[model samples]
Target: MGQLERATEATLARGARLVHAHPRTLASVVALSLACFGAAAYGIAQTAPDASDLPRRLVTEIVAHEDLPSQLEALAGHELQLYRSEQTRAGDGAESLLARMGLVDAEAAAFVRRDPLARKLIEGRAGKLVRAAATPAGQLEELTARYAPANADLAGTHFDRLSITRGADGRFTARIATVPLATSVRLGSGTIRSSLFAASDESGIPDAVAVQMAEAFSVDIDFHRELRRGDTFSVVYETLTADGEPITWNHAAGRMLAAEFVNKGEAYSAVWFKDESGRGGFYGLDGKSKRRAFLASPMEFSRVTSGFAMRMHPILNQWRAHKGVDYGAPSGTPVRAVAQGIVKFAGRQNGYGNVVEVEHGNGKSTLYAHLSRIDVRQGQRIDQGVRVGAVGATGWATGPHLHFEFKVHGEQVNPLAIAKSSEAIELSPAERQRFAGVAQQIRGQLDAALTVGATVAE
Candidate 1:
């Protein structure tokens, strides 16, 4: 017989002898094979170092449950792969992620961008990926990258493939990771009779978030007298990393929900948008433009109780034109940040109360007056809605309301009409595909999460 035939006969005879001697071993092997059929790899981690043309990676999360009454361990297996570059960023990344999903590069990214949460994942950027087999706990896996670095001669970085996969099951592949693509937080509602701030105190929105929400909508509404009762809001934002912390929110983002002035007869609803051209604006419920050429009222819910015209000045009784607007509210009524900018002046002024002036770029500066206190300092960077101070009759004010002013460069202008605007966050054409792929993958995770209880931890 040929060498192959002789070897086959010998192997079969040995197996038959062993099976006759130990019947239980054969039964156990057959049972295990059926249990883990397509879910298990035979020579996976045990592949010889010299072997090439390796099989594709394993995809599965091995979720363990302590409560299930079965004696056999429950197997929660799902496959996933995420690549980070045009070459590697497929599977879980966009073009790269889609490529990993066994799709053509172009198709993967298109799918991801079609969803909102997926577009957000590319923005959230944890910068690493996960691929698992036989486990639900995210296991760390080794990965590859194309770091197109410029050098003296070479114009692009080369690809470096590395791996760090987990052996057994648990969360995190044994490697460094990128942040997840999206983030969310739950909040409760509250009622207010006076202002949004008072109502926010009763809601779960921290003062910081409350301030930002007001600032985001300041272009359209006045918060001081506008907020009455049952006003509500929700946001979906960026995730950033300062040190080691996984950030939950970044201001360069979009918000999905907001409501206000229901206590009054008037009601307003809007979705904030930063368009692809980098212009930020507001859209009303009908998607009609709520944005005037210039944004009206630097702070929302704060009104133009005092207008830009001739008046008997409150402190200096003279028929002089009031160059700005006065926002009438109670003392210690926390003042809002009118727009995204830097603090240029945060101290006493000639006749203004504990004033805080902000430079909103493009030569625009807004001033807040009649403060019981100042919360920001000179040269400090603050956002649009952060509280700069509490209102009080400080400098030359007859009452608690704040004297607000808007200026262009050094010249004074009406605070109701700021014309220049800031840009919004967007994805480039190349990035769009990548963004979409990531969203699709996350949708898969979301689907899985919905099917399986997160109470799996329970």
Candidate 2:
């Protein structure tokens, strides 16, 4: 056993000491042991202890994995519960899952404590799911297995890893772990002023991606409040690499040009740039940083129904820091990766629920939380303006909304105001004709669509 394992074992021993002192359980245990000996003395082996003496009905508890609980619940369980776990080591599960089912209150711990060497072998870890069941006659059962981490590095970092198991006697056990993660992510920048869905549909960017594009530029444009009748944008950015393969974006670059908001009677234009210099930042056409201390959301046009502040947490009632902005909308609303990044997290989290964290270079990161469904996975590469998940209340939320957050190093910052305009790439005179051809094709499509709509109206 390593020093770390020994330390953990010693700590658990100290906690379980009180349970060993209770006379109530000792008496029942002694009585049971005597019965075992009595039967053994008569030639019956203790290996086959009397089952009739055990309880009739049983209760089992399972944690983490969804499949095991159903299997145990299928048994004639007297009662069963599925609870979250807090274990942090490999062997923490060995006994916890079955304690209730085997009616063995810390028996696993008791045995480990009795044998210091065995305790030494208990720590160090792996992932696992745990199940605990109880019998009417008063017995607990447990079962646990080594679990594999989706991200090997996360084995000890995500603390609630769990597993389920069953004993030959039909008892169930549950084990839990205790590694929690504090996350950071990154996003790219771009702008689209055309109708939300249309822009994405035309660009081959998903609706979620369009929404993200809108959100990324919202801080500077006030998309809901500020936009023009004719606006254009240009961009360049990085994509996240997973297993050495780039699949998604981690950051982006670009400009919003000629945003002709007729009502606003203004044309908005900006050059967005990512400062590769250690100073790190986005800039507007005026060379000022539009990046606020944070980003409003990673998604675009989702509508900021909730801002960051103290509010009633949909779950775990009480005031809590709403670390991100919430965009209220419908389920399955496409959520885009705000920047080029590798998905560091793509799973359920406390309060945040279904979440994805992207890590951009330079300690800058972004987070997309409170999602109903995730389209990506841990270590997956993503591009800026790519669909990474969908908006919905998967965690502690009041309704369908995307929770967007920006973090520098580890601190949250406003995503808006991040000057996305740095420098606009111009089509070389040689490439101008080619670019114009593409532009004309788009213009032709727009004209056709408007004409058809007019005819239909008439």
Candidate 3:
């Protein structure tokens, strides 16, 4: 035999002898040998050279790109002609609003006024989007108005849709429908640099939302006076959408569910909650309503021309205790009633000139002086923030300004100081329990929103 054949036979003979002497040990050795042989074979295969250019096979097919049909392109052009918008003013009538919407169809206007269903589209609440599709020649073809019902679930989860379409025969059909809208909570946090609106604009929050936020906390925080440069605010509110598109911010009827404002290192929070009676109001975490008996000022936002202190009278030219605060505004500015009360007086009063006094419960009352016109009658009941008169320089003043006074038990107390002590309405025992649950849920959402805002900011 050759040398290789002789070696193989010799190795087999040695293993057979070991098996006969120690069978278990010989079996283990045989298994180990087989394992090593498999590993060596695998290593050799891995180290083998790649057959990159070994052989070549080719297969080809032709594919053609399809172009959009001309009809489809025309349809898209028509769709682009659809005019979409939101109702801007509460005083806008069907004619004005339709004209603004570029719908010059007089028949549409008549239908809106006469048909109840069509009237719903035209005369319903403002702050809703009204869409119109017109022919290339500017003739109205279709119109749609969408708004949230007062009872819409959880802020913008539903929308009431009104559709008006012109038939091919020139007849108009109107119908009302409900559409499901996607609801999402958006969080925005802003630090004031110059003004609230400015900060809101910088933070991507709408000015309307910013105004609402200020109103929500106005009882405790004077946006005009108390706002500081570094004051921060975090807001969590609702946004409604359809077909993955969000509605206009003006028409977004969602409430500010939660808000946190850190002014001068003091934190204030407001959470929206509805009691058992379905009365919804903003309350603190402890279930105290943020609504005070009076707003800090008669105006929503204005600069203080003069404070409630001794100042030289422009007309008298003598130093006297200014019983009320003066807010500088234009002459036709609408003055607001500071509190809910009967119109105690609504006319001129010597140096006070055109003035209105409203007496409230607890022997409290407010006085608004210096007016160009009076809108209330004596003994007529009025609510807070109602237009009492217009700002004018009719009183003993050099310019148009509102002189506001707060009286408690017939004695004048600085309105600013009284506003600080304005009482808050506390929820009842049962109401408090319900509010706690709602508060807890809102708290969780606020935290998540704040975290998301922080991440985006980073």
Instruction: List residue ranges in candidate 3 displaced over 4 A.
Output: 1-185, 239-254, 312-320, 330-334, 361-363, 381-387, 390-393, 397-399
Worst 10 residues of 3 by lDDT: 242-251
The TM-score of candidate 3 is 0.61
- lDDT for predicted candidate 3 compared with the true structure: 0.80
Q: What is each predicted model's overall lDDT from 0 to 1?
A: 0.53, 0.53, 0.80
lDDT of 2 by residue, 1-458 (tens): 89999999999998688567886887889999999988878775556768788878788986666577787787856555533322234455436534423445455455444553333324545323333344454343433323333456553333233433455865434444433433322222223455555543554333443443454455556765455544443222223222222222112211221111112544322223333333333333334343443344465465677676778776678788877677888999888776677888889999789998998767878888888898998998877667988888877777787888877789986565332432233334544454445444433443443454335336
Provide the TM-score for each candidate, comma-separated: 0.35, 0.36, 0.61
Which regions in candidate 1 have their CA more than 4 angstroms from the true location?
1-269, 272-299, 419-458
Q: Which ten residues in a row have the lowest lDDT in candidate 1?
A: 152-161
**For model 3, how does the per-residue alpha-carbon lDDT over 82-126 read when each residue is reduced to its tens digit?**
565656468877788878877677887888788888887646466
**Model 1 lDDT tens row, 324-378:** 7887776677777766788988888866858898887878888888789999999
Error in Å for residue 63 of model 3: 18
Better of 1 and 3 by TM-score: 3
Superposing all C-alpha atoms, what RMSD in Å does each candidate have to the true structure?
28.2, 36.9, 11.2
What is the overall TM-score of model 1 with all chains considered together?
0.35
